[model samples]
Target chain A: MSDALYHDAILALAKDRRHAGRLDAPTHSHTSDNPLCGDRVTIDIERASDGTVRRIGHFVRGCVLCQAAAAALAASVEGRGPAAFAAAESALARVLAGQNDPENGVWAAFLPVARHTSRLDCVRLPLVAAKPVFEA
Target chain B: MTQALRSQFPILTPSLAYLDSAATAQMPLAVLDAVRAFETSSRANVKRGVHRLAEAATDAYAAARSDVAAYLGVPPSEIVFTSGCTAALNLVAHSFGALMKPGDAVLLSALEHHSNLVPWQMLAARSGIELRFLDVDAEGRIDLSALETKLDARVKLVSLAHVSNVTGSVLDVASVVATAAKVGARVLLDGAQRAPHGPLDLKTLGVDFYAFGGHKVFAPHGVGVLWARRELLDAMPPFLGGGEMIAQVELAHSTWAAAPAKFEAGTPPIGAAIGLGAACRWLGTLPWAEIAATEARLCQRLLDGLAATPGVRVLGPQSLQARAPVVSFALEGTHPHDICQIMDSAGVALRGGHHCAQPLHKRFDLAGTTRASLALYSDDSDIDAFFAGLSKVRKILL
Candidate 1:
């Protein structure tokens, strides 16, 4: 995705909740903090029966970049299973480093978030929290 | 003396506003010269050497100590040089922990910085001494009425800051000292924020101990002074033991040196101390009354402007009567970090966070606040620029 496309997508995603994937699954949650600014993001994950990520949701309690990241992450991993979740994680990492392309067949849901590398961690909150489920 | 003094400090240029003196004063040319002179002319270990270079180094270090004592209005025997104010407070806490028994109490004010509060908390935890905090009024001034009610015979020590780093409240040290005196509890006044602003007369202040850092007062970093009464210093056991602090050492027992020497165990920050002394002398020559008045005016302007601005809630006292030049505030429905980022974009520097006083924030039920602190060199333009930038930020953010 291009930078403008990603920015527009993220901005639109932030403004409209319909673009955010269905929050249908039972969600377990956790929060992480950025001590420097006291910014925190609470990660909520919805897992499939086979322990794959059905959906990822996040409520960011921090800055604008962080809020954008959280909203973008929610839109990215809506229908992905376990392998797709891994691919999305790798894509999120690359996007955080200013790379817009999706790696390992995962489309960039968090492309707008990749523009701000400093806020990459905020966008990756759900993915970070869901990693343990995939690993097990 | 003014011309000679101005020539000695290179930062006395006409263009720079240099109003951030309260945050960190500009280093005088004398301090820089002393540092360079020490590094280039004579560099050697102190107290143990007999050669010419060593003698000069030792003399320079001792002279710096004497200068600091004189500057703080304490005797040379009472000043113990440490790394910084945090280190000085830690030393007192650790040493007092060694002396304090169970069932004792440590009283502290709500306006204290974390550096002052954490040490006492650690001491209380280790010694089982109950820790109590004196409250603050709505104006962010320490409630001395509450302090009187809380202080009692069981209180062993009362640690407070001479000035509130966040609210810029100038604590009435005389009243605090008298209250502590009634209970015979030792008092430790953290002068880290106050020492740079004006004269510190320890003899008249009557506090048992005072601590301040060098970097905040136009001196080099890694240098601070902890001034304690001579008898108190003698009574407390040595904080750090090493080669120099000891008088004699045998297989079975060891004896320690006198008050200040006993606390300074290893090779000290010789260059930094010399720089601090030069800075002190340089500061002594400046028009302190003029500086104080200028800072007060700037503070008033800032408070007035901020108060006039819609959606801006000034945090401390409404007036600049008893406060320093530091002003903290919160804009309606805006995070402090965002305000800081916007202000930075406008070329207006300010600090936005807990200001290292989280308890004060918690007491006031606030998450954080944006603070703009002023110094001696600050003037009308700086305050105007700040207000203009703040107006822009409010328009953009709110």
Candidate 2:
């Protein structure tokens, strides 16, 4: 009855996932397991010479919250570099903790989880694994 | 009794659909009132104080013990109360395990919940004994055809879940008993999931030890029972050394008390025991035939709905043949934790993750699963609502 936690945009993002499957011979690939829920997510990224992300592929097996977070990051992360990921990570953390940060860009879709705290780990874990895949 | 039964469970309201009875059942009004009455009127330490209140409390506690024993079809002296099933299994591992020598093997099924498996593993690791497993088949029942090769003189004991926590498949206990008899190995059934399903006849079952938790059977928490054969209880050593389990205590040495008392050391969960007795009495009012019929109906509807749905795979026996009301299933690419959260959002309560059976999850090549187990109060609407929530999961997730 109370479906506030799972919104339309979030579900839509979860449904049409981009950058899915594996990235073979990528510059960086890391698999993270959330032992708490047995939810797994792996992120693969190929960085360009100018310190920008050229391509990103992810494999996520978990809840819609985590999947949406993964999809949100995966869909828009190619043009951004490690600096943007580093900034977004901190901003998303602040937003998820129920704080309004002007610096929190592109992670606004995750703000609803700030109200519902139990799904915080479900949403943040994949993003946590995806960030910092490339060196400055 | 069925009409009255629904109202007795206060937690069964209009909105919520509680389908996780395998974890622990919601207490009926009778159980609640019993606990309250005991705490209010007969509140005193049992068996020690000679005062009127103390004497009454001791009698009430003893009466509860008798009621529970009768419910299990055993003598009061045969049942040993512990904190819960985990404690009961631990006591068995310690007391009964002491009788085994090194190189002697303990037999277990692959589908055992962590409660039944870990204590024996600890005992085996410490005692230098080997551990063996009976494989579970694709349908999730114990493969008894392999029993001939697994059992031998070296296998001293066989422990199994009477009904699996995750799969809800009821083991063929009679077959297991007959096979273990060939090797002269003892049998113990973890009846935590079985206790709430219906009335149990442990005496006829003839297992050496039967373990169950009070909370899983509409009783209050913090109490469990270990029902053993009287001869076995008398032969084994006391698991815990404490105030109540002693006969004559000198500074140097002391003799142990009787079978039931020897295992229950220190102050027990007195109020919870009374609640458990009330729960047993409440359970007796409902006919087992009716409970079974209702469970079958609810289970069939849920299974049929899931079976017809795309990308949903029900774990364990698809039909009602050898399974309890417990059912665990997985949605393609949807983590059980995710499914559980979405279900909770729609007011359908369920359990997710390994359900304390990680090895079973590993056996099925799954990280975890979403489980919806039914109680007597569960109805056709409950199944429909659960499926309604379930239908949204794949749409929302994929």
Candidate 3:
């Protein structure tokens, strides 16, 4: 059932507020919205001169799944470069689509989300907001 | 009696308590049987064919119209069947809106569904007509106290919800009609939430237009009714142009048919229309007063249960007076989607979101709320399961 989707691990990740809020002056940021449920996710990043990520932040006005996804994404990519962020996003997408498992991280907390097809987008909104940075 | 009523809806199981009737009600056996009978015995294109099956289909369609008209207490000729409530409202907006000057206004409420509000916005953009809104009160009812200031000779229409889908606040129709009569403004009510509760008499309500969807009334989807005064229908042009809507076509021009046929362009949802007519006839047999009393009792139970909870806050009118059995509430520190997910696992179906009334949610300073709406078939078990689900939500999310 969908009840398994709200496990303690995901709830704890969602409750993690260290990465919540905007950067003082972000180098890049993007916002994505779930039109069906009116959930919004904003991902802000501060990058070094070498284009590596210095810090990551997120602001989510959405459900628990969305908040957890954003928190996990921010925690995973804080000290990494764009290539590492892309790899993390790919791993999560594969796990959510039931294609593969997340390599080794808190992303496994999102494994239950695969069964609830209606909520897959809720877990993906964070990744969607972060993609445009690499593209630019 | 509740068991017997519940049994008529084959989808209702003993373990499943559906509280999302405001979204789309489950169809009863009578309506389903009517659709099956029509499809199996006499299914054909309506209004044009000369064969025996075609004649039977045409007759059934007309009879369905008559049945629906009888339910609305209006003449069959005045009822125009559209694809759904959205289409019905759009038909009026496009056709009647074409009659307005650029400066005329259509006064609508702040609490209208997107179906009611967007079409008027589109009309305003197309015709350069002014659009005005009546403020919604703190309790979510349409505040018509200041309506006189908004009314004038320039306002052509005053459209509002008969009963709000999100808040369940029933509008004061008599007061609205009386006030609008002063400035000669026509009234249209989006009756999508109200139609499922009981039968209605448009003549007594004295409104110029009414629209409701079939799916909300236990009939099939893709069908709805738009009732208008015959004179208004006669004065307006056709919203759409197709084969059935035209009388005689030439390279240069074509003449239009009468009101109902003129509004229904292309092929209609014949089976769905037949099913809606059957549903109306079936609903006519039930005792609405008794059903209303049971619904009120169930609503009170739900309200008291929500009140008893630690963090729960009801959004609409707390009292059951002058409201449908729709209840939207917010629990502190928990999102509506999470509550709904947990509730669904507990075998209780509830809807959680803005319910297409985003402005109303914004008015209440909420992102979304969990909604439990009832129908004639809903009983005490549904409410019991609802509270049980809320208890589970408290344990898990809180």
Candidate 4:
């Protein structure tokens, strides 16, 4: 086997995501295209009474990195409030700052993403698209 | 000699499988030496130089033009050097398209690269000339039946690629020429992909214009050749006005130079022109029949290997005779970006995108396909690495 950038977990995330569809009448949804590579991703979510995410769905046409990140984001933000969103944002910032290895958190699955420093946005585009929705 | 070809390319390290020659070829040592020799020994402006160095540079530049013209079997005066193939096509679209009037139409194939398509489209929009298409089959070859049906009195031109960069499908130029003749429409062929593969004789092609990139034929960038029939060049207005392309300059109106000189505006790509000449000379020495046989073998191996893998769908003609060395395909259940990344990890460099043939990609109902093209440098080992890399993607993504 080749020394691939994607490990088993990242590939697993890419293959099948629970949030791989669009939600009808989503409370907050936004779709954006990555201008450089022309990959598109849509984030959809329903919020609970406490302003936490009730359910999430994603319609992404992108690379494995984006798809895996979308799947990871969907899985991580379940039932979490605004505090968790901020933590995820901070973790994403650290990644942009050249910290490729993050441990024991929802973002830790993205450890393999550091190799293509150029592709940082592919792993983070989902969070950027969905974060604004949760803020409202 | 074929085996020794690899050593001539410095970029072909043992581990790197550079499979993207359809995009741009790697430069050979002969070209580099020629460029270095000219730049270091006799570096001066061309054409109007009076000194020894200036005269040497001018001779070298003119010699390069003669070399390229010889490669294409055209006289030097028929060849116009341009920035690249796109510029060459645009020169025609603007210059020839000027002669076209309202109700006049141009027929193009869906298989043309954007370089050939967009220029004509722009002309059609600017002028009232109608734009038409020759239908492309699912295999990505242009339908000659459609061409016969579409050719009519109103059609002024027929422009197409000699080979489809996306599908690696070769167009039947003779049939296209015959059909266009029925309508009395002129033909302009994009030879960007075709020129690198083999020698071209303009008399045999019988097209009004043929344009190709020098970089694609293992030369340096920025130098491209446009061969137009002398009469057509004389008839068409100069695309640009500047020092070299002029005859007599007046304050208000300036007379233009003859044919090829009229099309070439400013000082040309000097070093690049010399390098391209060396590249053409190097290709001229090779046994093309032997080269074609090897390419066919390598292409078949690539296609067959891709076919063997599950979920892999090869695009274009299955027969080696029907296609160029390019192989564009999409793997089911995997995006091109994913496939490229996974393969890239294995040091297999292939292209993954629309390849600037977006209309053809749209016709295929694909966002893009991964392309792996071969050249003289390709071997059985590269094909093995490609299939091996693809299998890895299959294992992971599928």
Highest lDDT against the true fold, candidate: 3
lDDT of 4 by residue, B1-398 (tens): 56688889988988989888888999989999999999999899888789998999999998999989888888999999898999999999999998889889999988888898899889989898899898788777888887877889999899999988978888888888887888899999998888878888888987889999988999999989889988999999999889689999999999999988898898899999999989988888888888888888999998888888777777788887668999999888777877788788888988887788878877888777899998888887888899889887887776
Q: Which parts of model 3 are misplaced by more than 4 Å?
A: A102-105
DockQ of each: 0.19, 0.41, 0.78, 0.34
Off by over 4 Å in 4: A1-4, A27-38, A44-56, A72-97, A100-136, B249-253
Looking at model 1, residue B342 earns an lDDT score of 58
Q: Considering summed lDDT, which 10 consecutive residues are worst modelled in model 3 chain B?
A: B353-362
C-alpha local distance difference test of each model? 0.74, 0.85, 0.91, 0.84
Candidate 2 chain B: 10-residue stretch with minimal lDDT: B1-10
lDDT of 3 by residue, B219-309 (tens): 9999999999999999999998996998889999999999899998998999999999999999889989989999899989988989999
Q: Which residue pairs in candidate 4 collide? A: none
Error of 1 at B193 (Å): 1.2
- Model 4 backbone overlap count: 0
Task: Label model 3 with its docking quality class.
Answer: medium
Per-residue lDDT for B1-398 in model 2, tens only? 44567778888897888998888899999999999999999899987899988898889888888989989899999988889999999999998899999999989988999999999999988998889998889988878888879999999899999999988899888898998998999999999999899888997897889999999999999999999999999999999898789998999998999979999899989999989988888888778898789988888888888899888877799889988988899888777877887888778999988888878888998888899999988887788889888877766665
Cα-based TM-score, every candidate: 0.86, 0.89, 0.98, 0.90
**CAPRI verdict on model 2?**
acceptable
The C-alpha stretches of model 2 lying farther than 4 A from their native spots are A12-32, A42-58, A71-93, A114-118, A127-136, B249-254
Q: Spell out the clash pairs found in candidate 3.
A: none
Who is ahead in DockQ, 1 or 3? Answer: 3
